[model samples]
Target chain A: MTTPPLAETILSFLKKINPHQPLPTAEQNLFELALLSSSDFITLIQLLEEESGILLDFTQIDPAALASMQGLLAAFSAAETGSKL
Target chain B: MDHYPWLSPPDHTAQALRMDHHLWHYGQLMTHAELLSRAIDWSIAGPLRLLAILGNQDPWVYPAMLAAHRLGGGFLPLHPAFPSERLQHMLHQCQTRLLLVTSDGLATLDQLLPNLSDSMLCIITEDTKGNRPLLFPQHRFLDSTDLQQLPARPAHPAPNTQAAYVMFTSGSTGRAKGVAVSFANLHAYVRYWQTHHPIGPGDRVAQPADITFDLSIHPIFVSWASGALLCPIPPATRFAPARFILEQQLTVWVSVPSVAMMMERLNILRPALFPTIRLSLFCGEPLPTRTAEAWRQSTPQGRLLNLYGPTEATVAISAFEWQAESAQQEPPGNVPIGWTFPEQQAALLQEDGSLLLSAGTGDLCLAGSQVTGGYLADPDKSAAHYFYHPDSGATLWYRTGDWVQRREDGCLLFLNRVDQQIKRHGYRIELHEIEHVLRARVGHDWVAVIPWPGGTQPVRALVACVAAEENSPTADWLQHCRQHLPSYMVPSRIMVVPQLPLNHNGKINRAALQQLVQATLFPTEAT
Candidate 1:
């Protein structure tokens, strides 16, 4: 089985959480738009972990890295790569 | 009345509070309070009027509160995270001309200066460094360093009848209502706590709620009056409250039940995590039985109490002690809101102006020292909720608007709010205000905002059902709501329906709307 792209998975999750709002692009800042709060960010991490089977080190992850779609993709990709090793 | 009861003797050496790396002794806290009081007296003229304190939890909050009382003024604490518009509304509502803020709060005020009235003056506690020029040119800013340099003067005695603090809660009409509590009310609360759950000098009380919240008043005043050390939990530690309790070695823990729910969600609520906690009090929102059980398991040695009261009734007016033997007897997943304090009286009244004596449910009416006279500068709104007791001639009772059932044991079980208000994440929100904003945005009066898991289930999210014109876009309506309301007030989901279902009474049937929302969200369950 092939893994889906990190951005695709995240966008799918975002769409699931907010079905009414317009789909956010990868470059859009999720935090500034009030689409996600700190607790929501924590939920996002949990969802990502469940989907990818990669346990994230919550203490090591910077909250700023999850503020934007592009940032979240990068953080997830890095975590997935670290888990594979 | 020469000095407050919290102040230690001049020669005594004991820690009064611990924040981060800072530890303030009781003697030192008194001297600092005196210094701040003298500075305020010299800088401001006449009676202190309304003083606003805006910042995060810090040792300065105690001194600022003490100084405001000493100057015969009411202190209003503003949440630094609140939008500038909400802050401005509160500042104007209470007519706060004097502000005591930290450096961060100064930055927030700087952004809101244009919206603020010109009569406001700010006395900041931290040095601005080179950020002095960032402040509004018309307003004066003084630092704590300057306050320390000023000559000390004798503190003035504040009358017990004077207002102590003003806290703003969400109003159903889309405006924040300021509830001004007097010093006498606070004294009554303090006396009640002293008689029931007394805290001594050795107790280390945990401050979990933000300063802007009424729940925070419990730890602040209770600790001060008892000379107990106050341990403020940082924002990060709140996510893992049980761990924070263990690390801080807190003896008395007071917080909203939502914190316990969060602990349960994180799976961190294990038995014996809080062996040192002697008292665990939960209030603000209804305490779920599961959350209470988890908390009790963690702090088996501590006495668990579920307190219930609105902001209008001071911090809390009634308390129900949770016990393991009576756990099965409580409502499925809720703790009972027990007897009222000695200084307060509670009565349940039905819709037809009849009292619910024994084993009947009705709207809860509270009258006592804790209940506020009314909202500040809003006599109409105050009169709407407050009325003369039918039997007790001339006694004013504030209708809680909360439906509660009186059990055979005399304990009250919270049914639900009589109005459209709901508690989500421990913050009180008015469903009508959301519907009102949506109706205005959608250009239609037929809109119903319902909380999913509707009746009795803790509200997780708001779902707005609107009857819009054919092909009317919901995204635009959501954008408009986002612009006007706070993030918490915004509906999580928007369902555009052709028409809202109404019951035989010609009212928007909330039960139908709630079912529609649930069915739409979970199509599988509906079938």
Candidate 2:
């Protein structure tokens, strides 16, 4: 199962939040970031990817993306523009 | 000389460990270890230095461990994924004398270095054998480079009494406790392979468990001794292992049941799809019969066993062989932990705390050569869990805190835990560990964490219930969890209830809370 990079990152993020239910399309962000710590929410995901065994492709996840749908879409848009998710 | 098969691979030229989509022979494996041991010798002075290997599933991690033992001291394999603070606590608790870090792991170690006052030697290594370049450049650390010569001699194995490896597990007091396994305990576990399971050369055993997890030890020792290949499935790819399995033609499979369940969710565990799998072993959590059935169906020719043990008891002590014909006969709920290994002794602890030799349901306690010595630097904690029972003869018994029932057939059925420790995703978590971090915020102690959709289903995430008043902002409580706990320990969802329901005993009733969380989040789950 080769998931597109964006979908894989989104899937991992979704797993952390709603692990049981598969929800929210890529464009649709039912995000709840009230709990994201400053350390985890970074602009670039290089540091997280470096840590081995992590499932999420940090590039697909914008540290600020989960704050709201706009942030999520903007992050995806940035990723589409070739920014690391 | 004790013939510890694991310490010496039979064929130096045989394919040894496979990782990062590359095959590394035993020659390269031993050379890497020799280079690491030589590096340790140059940096550290003592013979009994405790070496903490800090890295992910990077190629050099295992060699680092071998290097630690080569120096005549013990090794503590740490997961770089853990928060730096937790790593620092472990390093400090051991008063570590030697540390080995893969170049990629240096970033996390960098955060911990300043706080550690103990002047120790740090060796920076890469998958030099795998030809991966150093992720970072520096003169401050020693790197594993071109490695050629074989170890001088498999010098008689280290004294059985000396520490072999120390595994730090989740703690309720907000600090992880290190369970130190002696050379004797590890050897006993490896010896289990000789009489039972009888695996040897040509077996391509799967390596999914992190080095931090004791489950990983089975492949490391068993494969090395038998000249079987230790095929490592990298972390990011572990979730989607079907491709890797078929590609590697992995003959032996091992993992926590959670990983199999995830594979089932992905819909790839089809019938007779993996004929190459000759053996499958699942541990670290309850193995649902449905999951086992699907797994067995996927590998029709493979034999499956559910093994059970605590970290205090090295790796696994008991195993239950699963058969397709006996599906109807298998005990309800999870597969029974079955009988203890031949060399091991198992006794049940009644509610009165008295030990029972047989035929009763209570706490599971193990006593044998496989039981580990007490935790490092924590005598009080050790005393509380490990004890010499009047009936245990000479072996010290370690209380597993697992509630188990001895069936009429003498096989043991795992029911649940006696305490707050719950195994989720093959990772042991102390519920109190999460509660400990949230206690300061909710002074009235109106906080409780319950597994979601709390029924027969495997726990997906933790749902924490907090008093509405204390958790007004909501994000603060979650952010607090995110800041303090590891990602696994953090509660995925926060429920701001007006007040928590209480039991007749007046203590916060976790049982009722579990039901409440189930009812609230999953109303249709059939409470």
Best by lDDT: 1
Model 1: pairs clashing at backbone N, Cα or C within 3 Å: none
Candidate 2's fnat? 0.03
Task: Please compute DockQ, using alpha carbons, for every candidate against the native two-chain complex.
Answer: 0.20, 0.06
State residue B231's C-alpha deviation in candidate 1, in Å. 2.3
**Alpha-carbon deviation at B101 in model 1, angstroms:** 2.0
Candidate 1 lDDT, tens digit per residue, B339-416?
A: 889979888888789766678899999999888888888999999888886678877799998999888888888988
How well does model 2 score by local distance difference test?
0.71
- Candidate 2, residue B62: Cα displacement in angstroms equals 1.1
TM-score of each: 0.86, 0.82
Minimal lDDT window, size 10, model 1 chain B:
B39-48
Residues B299-364, candidate 2: write the lDDT tens digits: 988999999888888889999999987589875667778899988888898878789877889888
Per-residue lDDT for A23-78 in model 1, tens only?
77777778666566444555666667677776544334444455687766666677
Name the TM-score of chain A in model 2.
0.35
